[model samples]
Structures are given as structure tokens and as C-alpha cells.
Target chain A: MREDKKTPSVRKLRVRKSHIKTRLVLFLLLTAALMLTVIFAQQICPYDPNAQDTSISLQPPSLEHLAGTDRFGRDMFSRILVGLQTSVLSTLCLVVIITVAGTAAGILCGYYGGILDSVVMRISDVCLAFPGLVFALAIASLLGGGLHNAVFALAVISWPKYARIARSQTLSVKNTDYISAARLAGGNSIQIIIRHVLPNSIGPILVTSMLDIGTMLMELAGLSFLGLGAQPPTAELGNMMSGGRSMLQTYPWVIIGPGIAIFAAVVIFNLLGDTFRDYLDPRNSRRN
Target chain B: MEPILTADNLTKIFDEKGKEKFTAVDHISFQLYPGETLGIVGESGSGKSTLAKMISRLTDITEGNLFLCGKEITRVKGKALRRAYEDIQMVFQSPAASFDPRRTLGDGIGESLRNHGVSKVNVQKEAVRLLKECGLSPEFADRYPHEVSGGQCQRAAIARALAIRPKILICDEATSALDVTVQQQIMELLGRMREEREIACIFICHNLGLVQSFCDRLLVMYEGKIVEEGTPDEVIKNPRSDYTKELIEAVL
Candidate 1:
């Protein structure tokens, strides 16, 4: 037979930029730096985060106290560093839980459809109905003040978006003939879902989850700022901001330190999410 | 001789919101003897595809019974369901959409063979052999569906259908989506495969000329019901219904 009748399908997969290698790498590097700083936060900062250092209180940025000192005589630089660690970790936990739970809910409903879909989707609708941040605030406050409570509240509020995305993505995929062919190939519902649906829907869900991590971080900071997260003495970016708000005029270093950390962390995560969304989404690609 | 496949009073009704209702396929019955190609021809929304899906157990049958090899399969479930699927396979119109984009064409072709108990190591090699049988190179099996032309993808699809060793094959407007020349090539390939196997085939399409030329018998469907059924020559020489006459006239 004429095997060379065509160039063959492999050649079409040209070694081009594809979807997200470069941008994903850049974002990943920025994220790794922040994560590493968080992982080794104590070694990165020399001062005791909670220790009273009245001797250096209100001192502007200097070689000794890089972020000066706060009103309580605690080191601002150390506090901000530790705060970032708390904020990022909490957000990571929240997004992981939300994405997992949401994607599961979406796939189940989308696969089985009918009454199960009705029940899960209605619950998703109810969750999506109210303002997500407000709902999170309510849940966090009701659960009492703590970092875990805020993460829990954030997860509860965030899962529906992922559920909606997963469900919709699954819906589109389930209609394709490959899925029917898989079914015809004697694949059970779960096999079809795990082998086919999951891989196909994961890209968008991941993109959304990455972006949501940034949002969750911001929300956690907001909750801590409002006194609903990160109890006193525990360094957290929002908590530091709250502590420095009163000393904004005299101890500008305190506010400045935490603000920059939060801003950079959120930007890196958001950029990563946007880049992934663009790269992973077939609609956004020109080659397709 | 006993028919290899039979559908009795098969029907499908779409009840939108329990108010607006439409019947996609009415009580339609047909019999396919072994090694016969039975064509169901009509315009779009003529229920030919719905019929194919119902027989292949892809779509839920709202009414009537299905008989394959003399066993009633009105409600296929559990292990029996899997057995039923192996007995029959369907090729969709959109060849590219019928194969997973993330996987190689070999994966798609080998899926049924693996399901039918072929070992993993040999499935790829077997799939390559099947690809060659379909007039494609072994390398074609390694490429994704989009990497090949429509005709090539359709060949891969047929190779996949053959992998299951099905007694009955359903082609749901399979060649309708291809270029006219590609359609002819796929038709020619399908004819060769039919000649070499004892598989009964159901060709669902809107192309009257293809049905008349390729199929042993033609069943004309209109608005969810079969308006006429006979050998192609019988229908072509002596049209029994206005719908059948009009369909032939349109082809002329």
C-alpha cells in the first residue's frame, strides 16, 4: 500500500510552542521561589517573629530589622515571611480540596445524568446563587476564628465553580462518539469516566483551581484582616496587615512588608492560572 | 435461514419537559441475515441513526425488543450487556470525533480487541496488522485521528470495528461526512471487508445512490417510520410509496 500517500499524523504535531510550556515554567519558577521561602521561612528571617523587641520598636527599615519593628515590638520582616507561609499553605489546602470535590461531583452528575445530576446540580446552583465571598465569610465566622475554618469556608464556597466547570466539560465530552465507542468496548461507567472524562476535563479544572488558589489566598488574608483568621501571635500576611494598619503612619515598614508579599504571591498564582487557561483551552490555540 | 439480527417494534420518543413531545423512531422492525448489507435511507432526522443506536444499545430503546442470534436483548445489563456490545459495533459519521484526541489511533483500534481478552502486549501488534488489512500502514496506527485524512480515519474506524470480531456492524452515516471521492473509497473498503467476513451490516445513510449500489436491501424511512422496504432493484423498478418514489426521483 502507499504508506507515503500522506505525511502521516505524527508530523503534524510539530515541535512548536504548543500550549503552556514556557509560561507554565515561568509561573512555576515564581511559585517555587515563594513556596521555598515559605518552607524555610524561619531560616530566611533572623528575628523571633513573636518576641517583644522594644529596643527596635518603630525602627524604619535597616540592616538589623529589614522591615523594622511593629507596635508590639515584633519583627515585621519575620512576621510577613511567616504570614506568607500560612496564607499560601492554607490556600493550597483549600484549592486542593475544592478541585477534588468539585471535579468528582461534576463527573458523577455528568456521567450518570438524570436524577443524580438534578440533585447535585441543584446543590451546585444553590451554592452558586449567593455571593461566594459573603457565603465564605458567613461560614468562616460561624465555624469560629482559625486558619482551618477559613480554609474550610473557602473550600465550601469554591467547590461549586469547579463542579460547574467539570460538569460542563464532561457534558461536552460524554456526547462525543469516542465515549460511546468506549462504552461499546465494554467499559463500565467508572472506567469511561476515569480513562476518558477525567483526562479531558482536568485541564480546565486545573486552570480554574490555580486561579482560585490566588482568590482563596486573598480571601484568607481578608478574613485574617477582619479578625476571623490567624489568631494573634501567629504570623500571617493579613494578620500582619491588620496589626500594622494602626501603625501605618509611624511603622510604614510593617504594612509595606506584608503588602508586597501578598501582592507578589497573588500575582504569580493568578498569572499561572491565566496562562494555563489560555494554553489548555483548545479555543484559545491557533494551531487547532 | 434464520436472520443474524432482528429488531421488533423498536421506538424512541423524546419527551421534552413532559410537554413538547417528538418521536424520533417509531415501531420499526427489520431482519438482517448473516453477511447481508441492509441500508436504511432517508433525509436528516429520518430516524436512521436513532435506529442504529437503538440496535447497538448506545441509545435506550423506549419500546420493543431486539434479537441478536435468536436471543432477546430488550434490556441488556450486567455481563450480558458487555456480551451484547461485542456482538455488535457502531461506526459514527464523525471519524475524528469517534477516537480520543489524546491517544494514538492504535489505542482506539485496540480497545475492543483488548476488551475481548487480547493481551496488552500483542494488542498493539494486532492493531497494526488490522490497520494493514484496512489498507493503512502500520505507522498510521501510531498517529492521532486528526493527523490522517478523512478516508484514512474512516479506515482506522473500520479497523476498530473489525477488532471486536462483531457478528453485526452498524455504520451510522459513516461515509456521509467525507468527501465524495473519500466516500467512494471507504465504501469500496467496506465492501471488501464484508466479502471476507460473515458479518451482517446495517448501513444508515441519506445517500440513495450508495444504498442502491452497495446494499442488498433498502428500507426507506420518513418521519420516524419506514415507508417502504425491498431489494434495491424492487424499490427502484417499482416504487410502492410516494416517499420512496420521491426519494428515487430526487436521486434521478
Candidate 2:
């Protein structure tokens, strides 16, 4: 009877393990494919993304132009490929900046809390208090219309969320017995923070950053859509959508193509992030 | 013989500037000579763990002096404080929580050796040897804290604490979380280690019965103050203070 009960449990464990493995592998492959396309955007484009061909202007999807042609007669497919490169790369840069800076500030504050911690935490509160997009809009306009400025604006508003996550995570991990043990083992503050505190606290921070990818992508696009980002001739998804908005009804393909790209990018990253969270979640892994 | 560790009127006040200040360890003093096992028994919130923490320098000493082999370490900071740790080590109540969940048992055991400039290869060899000395299998060195049983993890924690060969070992309710059988096993292991190495120990636990056999001397604390001190048999058989009498009655 015990063997009968144990056999199913052992099989269940194997099944759960493989289920986690397969989903993780699938999403990882999809993310890799998306990154490769973005990296080789320029080389892979059949037609120059910025070049105009007036004779083919407003043409719908055809064998020659996969996503139809815009009013400027630029191939929508080629523009989208290049636009993805810009959007994805900028979002990646923004995520890296905030994750590194916010994590550093948080770990220091949480580990060695003093006047500096209170001051930085309050500043982050102020940043978080503002509506994210509106603040980004205000900063983007103040800094002038460009992709870099929009990213900078978004970065300023986005970092506080990461800081808050990292801070809370650090606070929880700080009091764990291992931290006390590390101190007893002759680890200095910096050594303790790097070895004991960071490793233990990093799980939530990484998941938050992964989930932020899609939100950052959308926010970046939102800024560009408002004319405060990626000025004309720069193939950015949001700018392309803005450029083709007026012709939404007459030549809907131009607007619809980039909209779909944005949607696909957002969905892909969000799902990947979700899967990554599931994979890293200890509760789920430990169940089997 | 000169005491290996000494605490002189050590006090710890939480939120000293706040209106509602709380004294965790108040004007406490004790001494641990080499090869001695000093057990501190107190009820919950009696500041037994706080006393351990202050002695090990994990918590800052709000006032008074702490000496290790005649060296004052009360105001030591930074690298000096870290260097002071070479003579003192601690094992906490929850053994599983005392090892980094991300690191293997070997890494946690060898961490001090690595920090003290031991070569990577030697640290690994020493860690494995320590694990063996602590009665854990060699394969257990590669396991994470969560992967091992509580008794096994506690043994690993003991191994890590002994890695640097510190003069003093502080076990703050180290076996309180384990089952009765496992607790006895750990106590035996601790006794064997102490006898083999002559490392002075400050064993903090609330269980009067458990410490009676293991400790040479016992200090009964009440509300952060030492209420009574004697050898385990003397205190348990003939308590002096009212609180110690009450404690002994409750246990009996």
C-alpha cells in the first residue's frame, strides 16, 4: 500500500519538474528570437526603413512590402523591425539603469540605515507619489523632444518602484539569522551586503525588473506617441504610430502594423516575465 | 587562568533618544574562561539572546566594556571589529536560517576561512573536514540549508561556527527549535567538540532541564538582570532569588 502511494508521487514529481522545464525553455527561446531580430534589424530589412518611395505610397500589404507602405512610402515591415530595435534596446537600457541604481541605493539604505536612508526613501516617495506617465511627460517636454530625453524622463519616474521593492526585500533579508552569522564570520558591511544580503534579497528584485520590462516598453512608446520622443525619420514604434495616426481610416495598415508590433512585444515580454516568476518561485518548486 | 572573554557592565538600550526607551541587556557582566561551559537560562524576553548578541558584537554595546583576552572591543568598528570576530563565533536558534539559503553548506562553513585570506583550495578541504568533524557526511557539504534536516543543518551551523577555531563559541538557544531526540544529539556533539578543543562556550537557552547536564555553571536571568548564579546542581536544587525559585518551581 505504501509503495502504491509512493509511485504516483514520484511520477508526479517528475511531471511537475518537466512542466517547469518546458515552459521555461519555451519562453527563453521566444525571448531569444525576439532579441536576435532586434539586433539584426538593419541587416534583415528588405527595404531601407527610412528611405521614401512616393510611387508606392499608401500601398497595402503585398509580396514586395510585407506590412504595406506608409504615406511617406516607407515599408512598414522594415520600419517596424528597426523600430523594435530602438524600442526594445531603450527599454532594456532603462531597466538596467534603474535596477542597478535603485538596488545599490536600497541595499545601502537598508543595510546601513541612517539619515541618508530616510532622505533617499522620502525622495523615492515623492517620485512615486506623482502619476508616472504625467511626470514623464512633464520631464520629457522640459528636456526637449528626443528618444534619450524620453528615456531619461521615464527612468526618473520608474526607478522608485524598483527602489521600494529592493528596500523591502533588503529589510526582510537583513534580519535573517544568516546575516548575523555572516557578521560573526568576520564579514564586513560591504562583504555582508554583497554576499549575504544581496543574494538572499535579489529574487524579488529580479522578478520586479523582469515584470517592469513590458511596462517600461509601453511607457516609452506612450512618450514617443506624444511627440516628445524619437522625432521624425527615426524608426521608433510609437513615433511610427503617431506619424500614421491621421491616416488611420484611409490607410489603416500603417497604423495597425506598428500597433500589432507593440502588442506582440508587450505580450511576449509579459509572458516571459510571468514564466520567469513561476520558475523562480520557491513555493511552487517545493510543492513537488 | 585569564578569562578568554569578559563583559563589564554591558548595557543595550533600544531607541535611546525615543520617549519609550527599552533596555534589552541592562548592566550585565559575565566571564568565560577557556574550557568552561557557561549556560544562561531565562524566560522569553528576559534578554538572554540580547546578551549573547552584545557579547558577540552583533549588536552594538550601548554602554560599558567588552574584553577578549584583555583587549577592549567595546568601541571597535570597521575592520577592527571584523578582526575581533576571529576570537568569537555564534550559532543561532534556527540552524536552517543561520546558513545562506543560496550557498551550499560548504561555502557557509568555509566563509570565514576565505575571508581571513585562506586559499580557495584549502578552504574547501577545511570545510569538508569540519563537516566531517561535525558528524555530517561529505556529500552533505554540497546541499543547501533548506535541503537538510534541522538536526543536520544545526550540525552544519556548528561546523561553520568552528571553522575559524574561535576562542569562544556562543550558542544562543541553538537546539531550542529541534525535537527532543535531536536536541540531545546536538548537545552531545557540542559537548564532544568543546572537550576536544577546549573552546569556551556561552550556551543560552530557556530550558533549565536541558542545560543542567551540559553546563558547568548556570546564570538565571530575569528582566535583563542576572538574578542568581551557581553551578547547575546548586541552582536547580537550592535556588536563592525569588524569581529563580519561581523558575525552578515552574520547571519542577
Candidate 3:
């Protein structure tokens, strides 16, 4: 067999630097934009999200109202910004809870592969059989409508997909020679799962988690639209759109502002998730 | 010479629903003496690999007694089983898929030592020395499995198995995945190491010719049973079992 004399140090270094730089820039930009929106929400608005001015009610976009005024004379622009915070926060919470819980359950189910595996998978399958929205609504109604309740509902509904994916990946990884080698080397079941199985299975789990974040955001917005999520005066994008549907002909900015924010957030998250999927795939890197 | 390891009436049955129950290893018995290589030759599904696994305690013996160093290891579990593993290690067929891709080669080798409570500093030193001894560079310690060639990875695997200083090294088609040239090199390395360390080895393979040259004694398995067993010369030159004759004729 011929061994290559030249070390791939320079090539590897270049690939590493470029990959990290791209991810770092994208992460920083997204984080900064989200932070700036929260910090400047109060300063930029001419009126509060709940402030009512009857005289300027239903006003179109102008110098006084940047995104026009709603039927209640509340600034559409301000409400959208505040709603961004609520939507972002609730979605963030739902994503974290679902991913962590789902991935953990999936990993355990996949690694063990016996009675626990069967039971956990059956539960996940049952949860998955229900329409996500209807399931979340049923859960939210039972728990009583609020931001936390909606987040909890969405998380409960969203976790099964992650769990299933994680379980399958774990099952495949657990049988690999390394896991057997670890077992032979005196590693316990937990050690084999944690050290051998989890690390190998994490790539797919991470990709799924990233993709799930966007779905969770959309689900949260849908709940808010149905009045099962953030309450009035809380400044949620879905709630703002729902409140603006009646006077959409007179002041279109009420719907357009929140709609654009939701679109941008979803697109950015999807793009970031795609980038991660490509990066994590060894085949993709090998080709480059 | 007395046998260091022995298996009596070893059998493994697989229950496939609706289909007839399959016996992989059927009442197979073998003994491995110190400082000897017992080559188990068979076709695929002949249960040679299964028998090797049972002897190494990598898999449980379905209906048999396996004595390791004169101790009945069939019922061993937990710490006792682990102690048995320290004295008996296995090298698998696929070196590429054997080591955890996420960890460095050093970590994979060090894992065996760490589990047996070997000192941390000594593990590293031993890991490096073992890697070098197996014809791998010391720099291989920091690299992942994908970063190295298949032969190199297999060498690292052998090194990892040797890290615990196993008395009996089990090579389960260890050189099957390598190229012809690399195969000879690995076979030579294994033979030299066996002599140097006075380790008993159970070399399981389908290739009768390859093992005949390296192994002192040969065990020919057919349909989960040891059809014949004798010195390589007797098995290769004056084979009694029809299956063994067919195997040698096909290979030679």
C-alpha cells in the first residue's frame, strides 16, 4: 500500500478555519439581531403595544405610525417587535425542552433494546398518531391557556419525532464493534451508552433538533393564533396577526409586519439547520 | 501440553419466528494450549466465528462449559467476567468499524486499561508502546480511526487488545478485510507476537491455506460441528473428513 508523504495539515487547517468562521459569523449575526430587537423595542415605538389612541386609530403607514396603527390605535410596529420577543422566547423554551427530553428518551430506548425500548417506542408512536396542533390544543386546554402552558403543550407534542429518530440511530450505533469493544474492556452499560453510543448517534440527533426548532416556532405561532397561547397585551406575533385580520384592508402593516418577522425567522433557522446537516455529514466534507 | 482454554458441548441456537430453529454452533468442543495457534477453518455460517466468540466470552455459550486458564468462565459475570476479558482479548474483522470513530485511537486503547484500573500515566505510555509494537507510529495515538488506513487501524486494534496483556488473543477474521500484501504482514506480525509473548491464539478464518502456513494445529468446522482436527500437515496432507478435504482442495 502506498502511503502519502505530505501531511494534510495545511488542507485540514484551511477546512477547519473556514468552517468555524462561517458558522461563527452566522451565529453572531442571528444572536445580535435577536438581542437588538429586544433592546430597542421600547425606544423605537411611538406608542406602547397596548396604548390606545382613538384619534389615530386605523391610520395607515405615516410619520406618526411607522407600521400604521391597528383598529385599537396601537402601533403595529411596536406590537410586532414585542411579539417577536414572546414568540422567540416561547419557541426557544419549547425547542430546548422537546429536544433534550426527546433525545434522552430516544437514546435510552435505542441503547437498551428490550422491554423499556418497546414501551417507550409504543408511547412515542401513540403520541405521534395525533395531529400535532390538535394534540397541543387538547393539552393546552387541559392545562389552561398561557405562555408556559402552550410551550409545555408544544414540547409534549414535538418530542416523539426526536425520540424515534434518536432511538433508531442509537440502535444502529449500539451494535457497532466499538460498543462491543467497550463492553469487553469492562465498560458498563451506561458507560457504553454515554461514551460509545451517544457520541456516534449525536450527529443525526443534532440535525433533527435544529430542524425541529423551526417547526416548534411555527407551532407556537399557530397556538397563539387560536388564542391558546400568549394572552392579549403580551405582544405575540400570532396574536398581533389575529387582532389585525379585521382591519387588514385599511391598515395592511398590522398583518404584514408580524408575517414578515415569522417568515424571516423560519427561513433563517432552516438555512442554519441545513448548514449544520451538511457540515456534520462526513461524506459531504470528504467530497470537498 | 495442557490446554489453557477448553470448551465442551458448545452450542448456539437462533429462534427465528415461523422458521425452523437454527443451530449455529452444535456441540462443538475445542482446547487451546499455551503458545499455540489453533486455526478454526470453515465456510460462512459454519459457526467458527461463533465458537471463537464463545471461547473469548464475547458471546455467551448457549449450552456448554468454557474453562479459561482452568477456571469455568461460563457462569462468570460482572467483575469476574471483566477479569477474564483482561486475560483474553479479541480483534475483529473490520478494523474500520471496530474503533469508535469519534474518539482518538489512543482513547480506544486506553479504555481497556482504564476499565481494569491501570494507572492513567501508564496507560498512555503503554498505549503508545503497544501502537509502536504493532507497527503503528506513535502519532497514530492522536488521530481518529478515519484518519488512518485500514491496515494501520487493524494494527491499532491489535495493539488495543494487547494493551491488557491478554494470554489468549482471538483473531476473528482479523486479516480478511486487508489487501493481500497487508494480510501477509498482519499474519507475520501476529505469528511473531504470539511467539514473543507466548500467547495462545484462536485464529478463525474461511481461508484454509492461509492458516495452514501460520497455525500449528487446525480445526475444520462444517455445519456448526468440528468435522476434523489434527496438525496442519495431517489436515492438509492426509485429511480424513470429506468437508476438510473439500475445503483444502478448493483453497489449494
Candidate 4:
């Protein structure tokens, strides 16, 4: 083999090592901190987030009561932290469900494009026509207000986008010579679909999945703000924001605490997803 | 002698939305005997690739029958269809795309064997042995497709096809992607392997010069039909069909 003429230079690999180092550190640090806030909610917080005391109700940011206390005298700091945990867990569950459903739909339609593809795509198109938040709200209100119903309704509306992305990616890769090679090598349909088709189609699916996380967090927060998510007195971030809205000027810290949590969650996930897409991009990898 | 591979009245029609349609491969027939190299030479859209795809069962035949190593394989499915690969194997023009980029070259070479019930421990050893036989260093197996030259990748692809010990090997423009020198090297390698194993080969290419030197017999195709057939020397020396005459004249 002509090593000097054709081999991909090893210098690029060296550059890639440093690139991964910073990305791994930042992604892990943010995710770990978020996980810790959820896992050690009570141990770290000095007061019960739900235990309201009307005596010290109208307070602002201070050492004795971080993020101040609401009109109900609930500690906004503890509520926001705990609310971050709830959003993350519920979103994780929804992502898992949506990924499974969407990836399966995409692969099946993509690999076996015919009447099955037409039917599946038609269904996905119908689902996608409904605006995401409005559809989730309609379903949540129909299912009755609860965090779980909100998550489920959101999942129902969200999977089609992933499915559409996955389907298009799969269709593009389906007829490639490598896939034909896989088939001629005695790989059965299922094995070829799972091993060859899915792996090749995963890049777009992953990028979209990351982007969807940010969108879902926003949708979940909005649902709760509309009083359809985690019920009152539970200290959910969106619910706290909703509760603090009416008394915005009187106790600004109450809205500010949970507001920052929601903003941070969306920004952190979106940035991580952007970094991940850039990392996985083949053109960028080639440069490295 | 019984033919190793036979195609009778093969055809492929492409339908566009059930309204506008055209026949890609018209009725064509051929037979390949063990130890024979049959060259299919045609211009683009002459259905050479489509014909090869039908023989390998990569695409369904619209109307025809294929008998590979004494088994009818026109409509087989599941395990039987998979087992048909034992008798018929194919090498593609673009060797880079023939391999899964996610896997090491060795893993790709050994994949067919693994499907054939070869043990995991034996696969690596078998793959290395196959690579060496194809005039490559065993270490080449560990390298990814991107790390190797086009010539090297074609060699590895040949090694993969040869690993299965198929009775009939179909190479569809297998060396067209390489340089003159590399193409000669691969042709020589295939010549050696054919002599050693007595495997029937269906060589599809647009290069009339290479076909004349390498293949024993020739089938000239035009619009999916075999317009002429004979020994490559006869076909080149005394061209019969007008199309064949034009093809030979263009190359010479």
C-alpha cells in the first residue's frame, strides 16, 4: 500500500485528542452537576422547598434564604434546584421513548421503502402538521393536567420529527454499495437493518435528538407555566415561575430564581448539543 | 459439462410512478463454466451492471431464471437465499464503498465467514491468511478502508470474495476504478486465483482492451441485450455486429 501518498496523516489524530479533552470535561462537568442537584436535593438544601412560612413571605436574595422566599414563603433556591431535577428526569424518559419509536419507524420505512414506507410517512406527516406545544397542550388538557400526561403528550407530538429525520437519512444510505455488500454477505434483513442501516443513519438522528432535548425542556416548562405540568405546592420550576408571576414586582426574586433555572437548562443542553454535532461532523473530523 | 452459472431470458424493467417506465435489461441469456472468464463489455446504460446485479440477486429479475451451482435461485428467500451466496459472490467497482466504514478491513473480510458458522477466534486468523494470499501484508487487515489506497482496498475486497470459496465470482467493473498499473496487478491476481480454484468468473467492464487480453469469452451488450458473443480474440479480430465493430474501433 502507498502509505505516503494515500494514508490519512496521523497528525490529525493528535489534534483530535485535545479537541475531545475539553469537550469531554465540559459535557461531563455540566451533566454531573445537574445530576447532583437532583440526587442530593434534600441533603444540600437547608430548608424544605415546599414548607412555606407566611411570616417571612416577602423576602429577597439573602444568606438566610437564598433566592428569597415567595409570597407563600417557599424557598425559591431549593424549589428551582429540585425543579431542575424533575425536568431532567422527565425529559430523559421522553427522549428514550421518542428515540425508540422514531428510530424504529425511520429504519423500517427507510430500509423497506414501498407501501409500508408510504403508510408510516403519511402518519408521521399528519402528526407533524400539529404545532408541537399546541398539540401537547391539547393532549395534556384532554388527558387532564399532570406532569406525566404532559410528558406523554409531548412525546406523542415529538417523535415524528425524529422519525422524519431518521427516515430521510436511512433512505439516503439504503442503496449505497456498502449496504449492498452487507446484503450479499448473507446478512439477513433485520441484521442488516440494525447493524448497517442504523449505524450509518445515526449521525443525523443524534444531532436532531440533541436539539430536541432543548426544545422539549422549553415545551415542558411552558406546559407547567400554563398550570398543566407538576401541580402546585410541589415546587416545580415552571409552576414556581407561574406562582411568582402575579407578584412579579412585589417579589421579583421568586420569579427570577426559577426563571434562571429554566434558562440555564435550555442553554446548557443546546450548547452541549451544538458541540456534539460539531464533534461528530465528518468534515470537521477530517480537518482534525 | 454442466454450466456453473446460467441466466435464461433475464430482464429488468424500471417503473416510474406506475406510468412512465422503461426496460433496463432486455431478455439476455448466458452460461459460465467452471474455470471460464466471461467478459461483458458494454457502454454505460447498456445494462451490464443491472445484469450482474440480477445474477448476484442484488436486484430482483423482472423475468428470467438463474441457476447457480445447480440450484434455482430466482425466488429463494431467508436462509436458502443467504446460502445462495455460498455459490455466487460479487465484487463491486468502488471497493471503498463496498466495506462498512465503521469496521476494520479485517472485520469486513471475515464477515461472510462469520455468517457461515466460522468461530469468532478462527475468523481473525482466516482473515489475515486471506489478506496475505491476495498479496497484502496481514497487518493491512487492521487498517480501515480510508487508510488504504484504492488498489489496496480492491485487493482486500478480492480477498473477502475469495474467502467464501464461491464457485462463481462476479466482478462488475472491479478494476475500472484503479490506475493502469494497479488494474493490471488486480487482473493478474484474479487470473492466479481462477487457475488455483477453477472458479467461474463473470467480468463486467467497459474496457475492451483489458477484456480482450484477460477474458476467454466475450459477450457484447447493447441496451441490455447480448448483441454478439464469441471468443474475445474472434470478437476483436472479426467483429460481426455493427455495435461490436464500433466498440472495438473506438478502443483501437
lDDT string for model 3 (A264-288, tens) is 8777777777777766666545532
Docking level for model 4? medium
The TM-score between candidate 3 and the true structure equals 0.89
User: Which runs in model 3 stand beyond 4 Å of their true positions?
Assistant: A1-32, A35-65, A69-75, A281-283, B118-121
Residue-level lDDT of model 1, residues A13-91, one tens digit each, is 3323343667778888988898899899988888888899676678888887788888777877888888888899888
List, for all models, the DockQ compared with the true complex.
0.59, 0.80, 0.59, 0.68
As a whole number from 0 to 100, the lDDT of residue B36 in candidate 2 is 97
**Candidate 1, B151-186: lDDT as tens digits:** 899899999988888889999999989999999899
Clashes of 2: 0
Q: Candidate 3 clash total?
A: 1
Over the stretch B77-121, how does candidate 2's per-residue lDDT look in tens digits? 888888889989999999899988899999999999999999999
Best by lDDT: 2
The stretch of ten residues in a row with the least summed lDDT in candidate 1 chain A is: A10-19
Predicted candidate 2 versus true structure: per-residue lDDT over A58-155, tens digit per residue? 99999999999998789999999999999999999999999998998898888778898999999999888899899999999999999999989998
Ordered list by lDDT, greatest first: 2, 1, 4, 3
Best by DockQ: 2
Docking class of 3: medium
Q: Residue A221 CA error for candidate 2 (Å)?
A: 1.3
Model 4 agreement with the true structure over B159-199: per-residue lDDT tens digits: 99988899889999999999999999999999999999998
State which docking tier applies to candidate 2. medium
